[model samples]
Target: MGNMDISLKEMMAIDGAVGAAVVDYNSGMALGVVGGSKDLDLQVAAAGNTEVVRAKMRTMESLGIKDGIEDILITLTNQYHLIRPVSGRGGKGLFLYLALDRNRANLALARHNLRGTEEKLEI
Candidate 1:
Protein backbone atom coordinates (compact mmCIF):
# COMPACT_ATOMS: atom_id res chain seq x y z
CA MET A 1 0.00 0.00 0.00
CA GLY A 2 1.21 3.46 -0.81
CA ASN A 3 0.23 7.09 -1.37
CA MET A 4 -0.66 8.56 -4.76
CA ASP A 5 2.83 9.75 -5.64
CA ILE A 6 4.42 6.47 -4.67
CA SER A 7 1.87 4.52 -6.63
CA LEU A 8 2.44 6.64 -9.72
CA LYS A 9 6.20 6.14 -9.42
CA GLU A 10 5.74 2.44 -8.97
CA MET A 11 3.68 2.29 -12.13
CA MET A 12 6.41 4.05 -14.05
CA ALA A 13 8.84 1.38 -12.92
CA ILE A 14 6.96 -1.27 -14.84
CA ASP A 15 8.66 -2.75 -17.85
CA GLY A 16 8.18 -0.60 -20.98
CA ALA A 17 6.10 1.96 -19.11
CA VAL A 18 5.91 5.17 -21.08
CA GLY A 19 3.43 7.11 -18.97
CA ALA A 20 0.81 6.74 -16.25
CA ALA A 21 -1.96 8.77 -14.59
CA VAL A 22 -4.77 8.57 -12.10
CA VAL A 23 -7.88 9.93 -13.77
CA ASP A 24 -11.35 10.95 -12.75
CA TYR A 25 -13.66 9.35 -15.22
CA ASN A 26 -16.55 11.53 -14.17
CA SER A 27 -14.75 14.77 -14.85
CA GLY A 28 -12.27 13.61 -17.45
CA MET A 29 -9.41 15.06 -15.44
CA ALA A 30 -6.14 13.64 -14.26
CA LEU A 31 -5.55 13.92 -10.55
CA GLY A 32 -1.94 12.86 -10.84
CA VAL A 33 0.40 11.95 -13.65
CA VAL A 34 3.88 10.64 -14.18
CA GLY A 35 6.49 9.64 -16.82
CA GLY A 36 5.06 11.15 -19.98
CA SER A 37 7.21 12.30 -22.86
CA LYS A 38 6.67 15.39 -24.98
CA ASP A 39 4.85 13.39 -27.60
CA LEU A 40 2.65 11.66 -25.06
CA ASP A 41 0.37 13.89 -23.04
CA LEU A 42 -0.96 12.04 -20.03
CA GLN A 43 -3.61 14.60 -19.15
CA VAL A 44 -5.13 14.63 -22.62
CA ALA A 45 -4.99 10.87 -22.81
CA ALA A 46 -6.67 10.54 -19.44
CA ALA A 47 -9.56 12.76 -20.51
CA GLY A 48 -10.01 10.87 -23.75
CA ASN A 49 -9.98 7.55 -21.98
CA THR A 50 -12.69 8.74 -19.65
CA GLU A 51 -15.05 8.65 -22.63
CA VAL A 52 -13.97 5.13 -23.42
CA VAL A 53 -14.76 4.06 -19.89
CA ARG A 54 -18.13 5.71 -19.98
CA ALA A 55 -19.04 4.13 -23.27
CA LYS A 56 -18.12 0.71 -22.00
CA MET A 57 -20.10 1.23 -18.83
CA ARG A 58 -23.08 2.26 -20.86
CA THR A 59 -22.75 -0.77 -23.12
CA MET A 60 -22.50 -3.06 -20.13
CA GLU A 61 -25.61 -1.51 -18.63
CA SER A 62 -27.53 -1.92 -21.84
CA LEU A 63 -26.44 -5.56 -22.04
CA GLY A 64 -27.38 -6.09 -18.38
CA ILE A 65 -23.92 -7.36 -17.58
CA LYS A 66 -23.52 -6.94 -13.86
CA ASP A 67 -19.90 -7.95 -13.75
CA GLY A 68 -17.51 -5.17 -12.88
CA ILE A 69 -14.78 -4.27 -15.31
CA GLU A 70 -11.38 -5.57 -14.34
CA ASP A 71 -9.65 -3.43 -16.95
CA ILE A 72 -9.89 -2.24 -20.50
CA LEU A 73 -7.01 -2.91 -22.87
CA ILE A 74 -6.33 -1.05 -26.10
CA THR A 75 -3.53 -2.43 -28.22
CA LEU A 76 -1.86 -0.27 -30.81
CA THR A 77 0.88 -1.00 -33.29
CA ASN A 78 3.57 0.51 -31.06
CA GLN A 79 1.93 0.89 -27.68
CA TYR A 80 -0.55 -0.53 -25.21
CA HIS A 81 -3.04 1.48 -23.17
CA LEU A 82 -4.58 0.08 -20.01
CA ILE A 83 -7.53 1.51 -18.10
CA ARG A 84 -8.28 0.05 -14.71
CA PRO A 85 -11.09 1.30 -12.50
CA VAL A 86 -10.50 1.79 -8.81
CA SER A 87 -12.49 -0.63 -6.66
CA GLY A 88 -11.79 0.50 -3.14
CA ARG A 89 -14.49 2.22 -1.08
CA GLY A 90 -14.77 5.91 -2.03
CA GLY A 91 -12.70 5.16 -5.11
CA LYS A 92 -15.46 4.89 -7.63
CA GLY A 93 -15.24 7.19 -10.67
CA LEU A 94 -11.48 6.97 -10.56
CA PHE A 95 -9.17 4.88 -12.73
CA LEU A 96 -5.53 4.27 -13.43
CA TYR A 97 -4.20 4.74 -16.92
CA LEU A 98 -0.95 3.20 -18.03
CA ALA A 99 0.79 3.42 -21.39
CA LEU A 100 3.53 1.01 -22.39
CA ASP A 101 5.76 0.16 -25.28
CA ARG A 102 4.29 -2.94 -26.88
CA ASN A 103 7.61 -4.27 -28.04
CA ARG A 104 9.12 -4.16 -24.57
CA ALA A 105 6.23 -4.92 -22.28
CA ASN A 106 4.81 -8.22 -21.21
CA LEU A 107 1.08 -7.51 -21.30
CA ALA A 108 0.12 -10.12 -18.74
CA LEU A 109 2.70 -9.02 -16.23
CA ALA A 110 1.90 -5.37 -16.75
CA ARG A 111 -1.77 -5.99 -16.11
CA HIS A 112 -0.94 -7.95 -12.99
CA ASN A 113 1.33 -5.25 -11.71
CA LEU A 114 -1.17 -2.50 -12.45
CA ARG A 115 -3.94 -4.38 -10.67
CA GLY A 116 -1.70 -4.85 -7.67
CA THR A 117 -0.82 -1.19 -7.73
CA GLU A 118 -4.45 -0.19 -7.99
CA GLU A 119 -5.22 -2.23 -4.92
CA LYS A 120 -2.56 -0.40 -2.97
CA LEU A 121 -3.10 3.10 -4.24
CA GLU A 122 -4.33 5.68 -1.72
CA ILE A 123 -6.31 8.66 -2.97
Candidate 2:
Protein backbone atom coordinates (compact mmCIF):
# COMPACT_ATOMS: atom_id res chain seq x y z
CA MET A 1 0.00 0.00 0.00
CA GLY A 2 1.03 3.60 -0.61
CA ASN A 3 1.33 6.38 1.90
CA MET A 4 -0.12 9.89 1.60
CA ASP A 5 3.00 11.40 0.04
CA ILE A 6 3.23 8.68 -2.54
CA SER A 7 -0.46 8.97 -3.30
CA LEU A 8 -0.21 12.74 -3.66
CA LYS A 9 2.78 12.34 -5.95
CA GLU A 10 0.89 9.90 -8.08
CA MET A 11 -2.00 12.30 -8.29
CA MET A 12 0.21 15.19 -9.39
CA ALA A 13 1.48 13.11 -12.25
CA ILE A 14 -1.98 13.01 -13.76
CA ASP A 15 -2.37 15.14 -16.86
CA GLY A 16 -3.44 18.70 -16.04
CA ALA A 17 -3.29 18.17 -12.34
CA VAL A 18 -2.78 21.50 -10.59
CA GLY A 19 -3.39 20.51 -7.00
CA ALA A 20 -4.06 17.47 -4.88
CA ALA A 21 -4.75 16.76 -1.22
CA VAL A 22 -5.76 14.06 1.22
CA VAL A 23 -8.26 15.48 3.63
CA ASP A 24 -10.30 14.31 6.57
CA TYR A 25 -13.91 15.26 5.97
CA ASN A 26 -14.82 14.78 9.59
CA SER A 27 -12.57 17.61 10.80
CA GLY A 28 -12.07 19.66 7.66
CA MET A 29 -8.31 19.15 7.92
CA ALA A 30 -5.86 18.13 5.27
CA LEU A 31 -3.59 15.26 6.20
CA GLY A 32 -1.35 15.84 3.22
CA VAL A 33 -1.29 18.39 0.36
CA VAL A 34 0.64 18.93 -2.85
CA GLY A 35 0.71 21.41 -5.76
CA GLY A 36 -1.40 24.50 -5.16
CA SER A 37 -0.89 27.95 -6.60
CA LYS A 38 -2.03 31.27 -5.21
CA ASP A 39 -5.16 30.91 -7.28
CA LEU A 40 -5.97 27.61 -5.65
CA ASP A 41 -5.48 27.23 -1.93
CA LEU A 42 -5.81 23.52 -1.19
CA GLN A 43 -6.20 24.00 2.56
CA VAL A 44 -9.14 26.34 2.15
CA ALA A 45 -10.64 24.09 -0.46
CA ALA A 46 -10.35 21.13 1.86
CA ALA A 47 -12.30 22.86 4.60
CA GLY A 48 -14.99 24.00 2.23
CA ASN A 49 -15.37 20.67 0.54
CA THR A 50 -15.90 19.02 3.92
CA GLU A 51 -19.25 20.73 3.99
CA VAL A 52 -20.01 19.51 0.53
CA VAL A 53 -19.32 15.95 1.57
CA ARG A 54 -21.31 16.33 4.78
CA ALA A 55 -24.28 17.88 3.02
CA LYS A 56 -24.35 15.15 0.44
CA MET A 57 -24.18 12.48 3.12
CA ARG A 58 -26.99 14.14 5.02
CA THR A 59 -29.08 14.47 1.91
CA MET A 60 -28.56 10.86 1.08
CA GLU A 61 -29.56 9.84 4.58
CA SER A 62 -32.64 11.99 4.51
CA LEU A 63 -33.67 10.51 1.21
CA GLY A 64 -33.00 7.01 2.54
CA ILE A 65 -30.43 6.24 -0.10
CA LYS A 66 -28.27 3.45 1.28
CA ASP A 67 -25.56 3.58 -1.31
CA GLY A 68 -22.26 5.29 -0.61
CA ILE A 69 -20.68 8.01 -2.73
CA GLU A 70 -17.91 6.99 -5.03
CA ASP A 71 -16.88 10.44 -6.08
CA ILE A 72 -18.05 14.01 -6.49
CA LEU A 73 -17.20 16.14 -9.49
CA ILE A 74 -17.44 19.90 -9.81
CA THR A 75 -16.87 21.42 -13.23
CA LEU A 76 -15.61 24.91 -13.73
CA THR A 77 -14.94 26.93 -16.86
CA ASN A 78 -11.22 26.25 -16.67
CA GLN A 79 -10.90 23.34 -14.26
CA TYR A 80 -12.39 20.12 -13.00
CA HIS A 81 -12.48 19.40 -9.29
CA LEU A 82 -12.74 15.76 -8.32
CA ILE A 83 -13.44 14.60 -4.79
CA ARG A 84 -13.14 10.93 -4.03
CA PRO A 85 -13.88 9.56 -0.59
CA VAL A 86 -11.40 6.81 0.19
CA SER A 87 -13.07 3.43 0.60
CA GLY A 88 -10.19 1.35 1.91
CA ARG A 89 -10.22 -0.16 5.38
CA GLY A 90 -7.78 2.41 6.79
CA GLY A 91 -9.24 5.37 4.93
CA LYS A 92 -12.59 6.00 6.52
CA GLY A 93 -13.56 9.67 6.86
CA LEU A 94 -10.80 10.67 4.48
CA PHE A 95 -10.90 11.77 0.85
CA LEU A 96 -8.66 12.42 -2.10
CA TYR A 97 -9.14 15.71 -3.94
CA LEU A 98 -7.67 16.57 -7.30
CA ALA A 99 -7.90 19.70 -9.45
CA LEU A 100 -7.30 19.42 -13.15
CA ASP A 101 -7.03 21.84 -16.03
CA ARG A 102 -10.06 21.37 -18.22
CA ASN A 103 -8.23 21.77 -21.49
CA ARG A 104 -5.58 19.17 -20.76
CA ALA A 105 -7.29 16.62 -18.59
CA ASN A 106 -9.08 13.50 -19.76
CA LEU A 107 -11.97 13.23 -17.33
CA ALA A 108 -12.50 9.53 -17.71
CA LEU A 109 -8.83 8.71 -17.37
CA ALA A 110 -8.37 11.05 -14.46
CA ARG A 111 -11.29 9.45 -12.68
CA HIS A 112 -9.88 6.03 -13.34
CA ASN A 113 -6.45 7.00 -12.09
CA LEU A 114 -7.86 8.63 -8.99
CA ARG A 115 -9.85 5.51 -8.16
CA GLY A 116 -6.77 3.39 -8.56
CA THR A 117 -4.77 5.72 -6.38
CA GLU A 118 -7.48 5.64 -3.73
CA GLU A 119 -7.46 1.89 -3.72
CA LYS A 120 -3.73 1.78 -3.13
CA LEU A 121 -3.53 4.56 -0.57
CA GLU A 122 -2.76 3.36 2.93
CA ILE A 123 -4.19 6.35 4.78
Candidate 3:
Protein backbone atom coordinates (compact mmCIF):
# COMPACT_ATOMS: atom_id res chain seq x y z
CA MET A 1 0.00 0.00 0.00
CA GLY A 2 1.15 3.54 -0.69
CA ASN A 3 1.48 6.22 1.90
CA MET A 4 -0.55 9.40 2.15
CA ASP A 5 1.72 11.50 -0.08
CA ILE A 6 1.80 9.04 -2.98
CA SER A 7 -1.93 8.37 -2.78
CA LEU A 8 -2.85 12.02 -2.82
CA LYS A 9 -0.36 12.81 -5.60
CA GLU A 10 -1.88 10.13 -7.78
CA MET A 11 -5.32 11.64 -7.24
CA MET A 12 -4.05 15.07 -8.23
CA ALA A 13 -2.95 13.68 -11.58
CA ILE A 14 -6.47 12.86 -12.73
CA ASP A 15 -8.00 15.01 -15.45
CA GLY A 16 -9.80 18.07 -14.10
CA ALA A 17 -8.45 17.45 -10.65
CA VAL A 18 -8.23 20.98 -9.38
CA GLY A 19 -7.50 19.97 -5.80
CA ALA A 20 -7.42 17.00 -3.45
CA ALA A 21 -6.96 16.43 0.24
CA VAL A 22 -6.72 13.67 2.84
CA VAL A 23 -8.52 14.92 5.89
CA ASP A 24 -9.36 13.72 9.37
CA TYR A 25 -13.07 14.04 9.86
CA ASN A 26 -12.83 13.90 13.62
CA SER A 27 -10.69 17.01 13.72
CA GLY A 28 -11.69 18.73 10.47
CA MET A 29 -8.02 19.13 9.50
CA ALA A 30 -6.21 18.35 6.33
CA LEU A 31 -3.48 15.75 6.75
CA GLY A 32 -2.21 16.29 3.22
CA VAL A 33 -3.27 18.47 0.27
CA VAL A 34 -2.42 19.20 -3.33
CA GLY A 35 -3.49 22.05 -5.61
CA GLY A 36 -5.65 25.02 -4.64
CA SER A 37 -6.92 28.17 -6.29
CA LYS A 38 -6.53 31.61 -4.78
CA ASP A 39 -10.31 31.75 -4.64
CA LEU A 40 -10.58 28.26 -3.21
CA ASP A 41 -8.84 27.61 0.05
CA LEU A 42 -8.32 23.88 0.40
CA GLN A 43 -8.03 23.96 4.17
CA VAL A 44 -11.12 26.05 4.62
CA ALA A 45 -13.04 23.87 2.24
CA ALA A 46 -11.91 20.78 4.05
CA ALA A 47 -13.09 22.25 7.34
CA GLY A 48 -16.47 23.13 5.97
CA ASN A 49 -16.94 19.81 4.24
CA THR A 50 -16.22 18.00 7.46
CA GLU A 51 -19.58 19.25 8.63
CA VAL A 52 -21.24 17.73 5.60
CA VAL A 53 -19.73 14.36 6.30
CA ARG A 54 -20.62 14.46 9.96
CA ALA A 55 -24.18 15.45 9.28
CA LYS A 56 -24.67 12.65 6.83
CA MET A 57 -23.25 10.09 9.19
CA ARG A 58 -25.51 11.32 11.92
CA THR A 59 -28.50 11.07 9.66
CA MET A 60 -27.61 7.54 8.61
CA GLU A 61 -27.27 6.44 12.20
CA SER A 62 -30.62 7.89 13.02
CA LEU A 63 -32.14 5.78 10.25
CA GLY A 64 -30.59 2.59 11.73
CA ILE A 65 -28.94 1.59 8.50
CA LYS A 66 -25.78 -0.40 9.18
CA ASP A 67 -24.06 0.24 5.89
CA GLY A 68 -21.21 2.69 5.58
CA ILE A 69 -21.03 5.52 3.07
CA GLU A 70 -19.39 4.74 -0.21
CA ASP A 71 -19.18 8.36 -1.32
CA ILE A 72 -21.01 11.65 -1.29
CA LEU A 73 -21.36 13.87 -4.32
CA ILE A 74 -22.14 17.57 -4.42
CA THR A 75 -22.61 18.96 -7.89
CA LEU A 76 -22.48 22.66 -8.56
CA THR A 77 -22.95 24.78 -11.63
CA ASN A 78 -19.29 24.40 -12.57
CA GLN A 79 -17.68 21.88 -10.29
CA TYR A 80 -18.18 18.55 -8.55
CA HIS A 81 -17.18 17.97 -4.99
CA LEU A 82 -16.67 14.31 -4.09
CA ILE A 83 -16.33 13.08 -0.56
CA ARG A 84 -15.33 9.47 0.01
CA PRO A 85 -14.73 7.99 3.40
CA VAL A 86 -11.79 5.62 3.54
CA SER A 87 -12.68 2.02 4.37
CA GLY A 88 -10.98 -1.22 5.41
CA ARG A 89 -8.61 -1.79 8.26
CA GLY A 90 -7.31 1.30 10.06
CA GLY A 91 -9.13 3.64 7.67
CA LYS A 92 -11.68 4.87 10.11
CA GLY A 93 -12.02 8.62 10.73
CA LEU A 94 -10.39 9.64 7.43
CA PHE A 95 -11.68 10.62 4.01
CA LEU A 96 -10.43 11.55 0.58
CA TYR A 97 -11.88 14.83 -0.71
CA LEU A 98 -11.53 15.64 -4.38
CA ALA A 99 -12.70 18.60 -6.44
CA LEU A 100 -13.00 18.51 -10.19
CA ASP A 101 -14.03 20.77 -13.03
CA ARG A 102 -17.28 19.20 -14.18
CA ASN A 103 -16.68 19.92 -17.83
CA ARG A 104 -13.33 18.17 -17.82
CA ALA A 105 -13.85 15.31 -15.42
CA ASN A 106 -15.35 11.90 -15.91
CA LEU A 107 -17.05 11.34 -12.61
CA ALA A 108 -17.27 7.58 -13.00
CA LEU A 109 -13.57 7.23 -13.69
CA ALA A 110 -12.71 9.60 -10.90
CA ARG A 111 -14.78 7.50 -8.54
CA HIS A 112 -12.93 4.36 -9.58
CA ASN A 113 -9.54 6.00 -9.20
CA LEU A 114 -10.45 7.47 -5.85
CA ARG A 115 -11.46 4.06 -4.62
CA GLY A 116 -8.05 2.77 -5.53
CA THR A 117 -6.42 5.68 -3.78
CA GLU A 118 -8.47 5.01 -0.71
CA GLU A 119 -7.16 1.48 -0.56
CA LYS A 120 -3.59 2.68 -0.77
CA LEU A 121 -3.78 5.75 1.44
CA GLU A 122 -2.16 5.20 4.83
CA ILE A 123 -3.89 7.35 7.40
**Which candidate has the top score in TM-score?**
2
lDDT of 2 by residue, 74-106 (tens): 999999999999988999999999999999999
> What number of clashing residue pairs does each candidate have, in the order they appear?
0, 0, 0
lDDT of 3 at 66: 94
Error of 2 at 84 (Å): 0.2
Q: Per-residue lDDT tens digits of candidate 1, residues 37-64?
A: 9989998999999999999999999999
What is residue 13's positional error in candidate 1, in angstroms?
Answer: 0.7
> Candidates' TM-scores?
0.96, 0.97, 0.96
Q: Could you arrange the candidates by lDDT from highest to lowest?
A: 2, 1, 3
Q: Show where candidate 2 strays beyond 4 Å.
A: none
Residue 67's lDDT in candidate 2? 93
* Better by lDDT, candidate 2 or 1: 2
Cα RMSD (Å) per model? 1.4, 1.3, 1.5
lDDT values for all models: 0.95, 0.96, 0.91
lDDT of 3 at 59: 98
List clashing residue pairs in candidate 3: none
Off by over 4 Å in 3: none
Candidate 2, position 102, lDDT: 98
